[model samples]
Target: MTTSVDHDVSPDSSRRPPTEMVQLKHPGRVIGAVFALLLAFLLFRSFLTNENYEWEVVGEYLFNEQIMLGLGRTLILTAVAMTVGILFGIVLATCRLSENKVISLAAGAYLWFFRGTPLLIQLVFWYNLSALYPHLGISLPFGGPELWGGETNKILDLWFVALLGLSLNESAYMAEIVRGGLLAVPRQQTEAAKALGMSSWLTFRRIVLPQALRVIVPPTGNQVIGMLKHSSLVSVIALPELLYSAQLIYSQSFQTIPLLIVVALWYLLCTTVLSMIQSRIERYYGRGSHPTTPTKKSLRQRLRTRNEEVAK
Candidate 1:
């Protein structure tokens, strides 16, 4: 006698009863969606009808060479600043979570001072730091050659000063963001990792950070967009970033509003792209936290099992 293995063959889908309709309607969602559409339409109409916006001047300088150069500089500044800020933010966050009082307090105090001051003031301070110290250099404790610097302008140009200011200021905010992410993870997961013989650094790198990113990413995306626009503050230091470029053109041509409009449009474009990127990243990480819906094959398997049970 031969033993038979059961085959999970599904009944024909066409023979299955029709699915019941879902009657759980959300009236609030429907009303809110409609209101949002109407508001968007009204704003679009207003923008199209507003003749005082100087459409011609905006069109003329929107892609001017100087404006383009400034846009490039703004992108570069944002990338470098955010990178430095995030790297240092991780360090600060880790230090803050450490057991040592001196290290933790030092990190906390750094965050307090940086976050307490206005970023504009920070930019100005860095720009004028040469006045405070006159020169920047590093020498051996026993006295050796000055490692760097002849003049402040030569050593720290407006570019470096703006980058330094933006980075230091951003670190304060990012540190808090990162710290919150670290704290959000369950302590038991870390304990298990340590029990498994993982080193502190390895556990943080391999496990903690990936889990923390789900919490950290949304705020970090907002920070990235904010950093892009905040680079405009560099215009105050006469750095030829996008805003300064627009200002330069408007001053000579005497068409201020249109140039500003151009600047605003560029900012909107950059932020829109960043927002799209943020959405994709959120969806990718979100998958791990929530159960995924069954696919067609899984549904078939379930149906076959159900049919077998009915036959039995």
Candidate 2:
């Protein structure tokens, strides 16, 4: 009995056969990628080689004084409008979140009307507002004595109207964004702040806002970029912002496609810069909050471990 050694339990019992790995083939995916690259190359070649694009004229007027001026105005309007929108949006979001029914209702009504209406329609209406009210002034509740008055056309000039429409419309959208960010802050965080003897405003300003900014900043940046594009709508009212400026140049020289291309290129450049800034801001606010990404070696190790367990 002591001499009965089992041949099946050899010294190499722990050793396992090597697993052969075969990568999955995806010929369809490779073919599709090649076809797409070829199509893109052709399109890019056409942009350079096509005589109809008038690349020379585009180069000539890309930085024309008038075009630069229009771009400047467009940037200014975007800044001013977004500033007003952010400020007013914060107020609206706060009011909507308020305990008072009347304040919340009023904020809701404002959001409803502005968000429901088309921005273009709002811009046109504001530009032609002198039609509805010839003069604007503050007066008594019962239409008693007019304390002050001014011609509507003079008071609501093109710049003023453009700002009014853009800011108001943008505020409505921003309110929702701000409100959503505020809501993302956990209820427990606020409670903890309250326990630490922080006032409501202080809690929001300190604990809540810093955290909520991580959520708010990304969308707010997108809104800033959108405001740049939306500012072009003011061209309808002859505000002579970027797009309108291009239209003016083209209308005279009959270089419609080239001038339009210049405008598109400028817009693309601006949006690209804004996108980079947005990415930086998001990373700043998101520091220490997001989990670190796994390195390739770590990922491969994890997969190997999983496969070994599955084989066992």
Candidate 3:
């Protein structure tokens, strides 16, 4: 017997309701988010209701003339000291990497001494350097005739001493940072540059340095922020900086906590701005590498994505 097959199928045979999609429930994540929000709300409420915080005082001195001047001085010190540190650090890093044992040893010695000693002592020592050297000038080695001379205290003023201490201290840290960045570049890149008829200096300046900056800029930015805070140590030498300015105000006003709050707020603001700039620099240098960088998404966008995925 011949079997009969249906030539046409009914639409109902092919059609069925779309599968209901349910998003996976993460109860733990929801709990964690709720806990974090509660904690943040409590902290914020405390800040608003706390009587001793003296938000008014913070607002009053936030843009006070003395505070503004101190802020400017702090910024200047950080800029100049970091500039000197980066330049000297590059030299030190090069010396540390030199083939000559003596050159490398010298760099190592410099790093050891600076990195070993306390920065506070260094600042104090420089401030009191006139005690050791009665006069200051350029002279030949081993007490050779002085080409130029000046009184030590006059030449080594507070500003000069502060800068010297900060720059020297920063250079030691930056040296290691620079050396690490340089080492991050592969050996083959240098070899390839040489094969392409590039001079050693040209290869470093054009090929290695740019690539190394991806490693360098981040730590350097940290060093910059550290330098900004570390600058408060200069207050011991009576150099007027941000923290010192706050101290001066509180000393007279006797509103110690409020003045400190002012300083803390200013620091937070400055550091926040610096952090944004650092992120921008990082993104700029991080282009073209594998494992693409993730972009930030807002909460609303994320929720929308979650809903769409669940619908799918």
Best prediction by lDDT: 2
Question: Candidate 1 local accuracy as lDDT?
Answer: 0.91
User: Candidate 1 at residue 216, lDDT?
Assistant: 96
Give a tens-digit lDDT track for model 1, residues 199-263.
99999888888899999999999999999999999999999999999888888989998999999
Give the 10-residue window scoring lowest on summed lDDT in candidate 2: 12-21
Candidate 3 off by > 4 Å: 1-25, 140-145, 293-312
- Residue-level lDDT tens digits of model 2 in 1-312: 479766787555665654544567999999999999999999999998999999999999999999999999999999999999999999999999999999999999999999999999999999888899999999988869998889999999999999999999999999999999999999999999999999999998999999999989999999999999999999999998999999998889999999999999999999999999999999999999989999867767777776786566
Clashes of 2: 0
Prediction 1 TM-score vs. true = 0.80
For each candidate, the alpha-carbon lDDT, in order, equals 0.91, 0.94, 0.91
Better of 2 and 3 by lDDT: 2
lDDT of 3: 0.91
Per-model clash counts, in order, read 0, 0, 0
RMSD per prediction, one decimal? 8.3, 3.4, 4.9
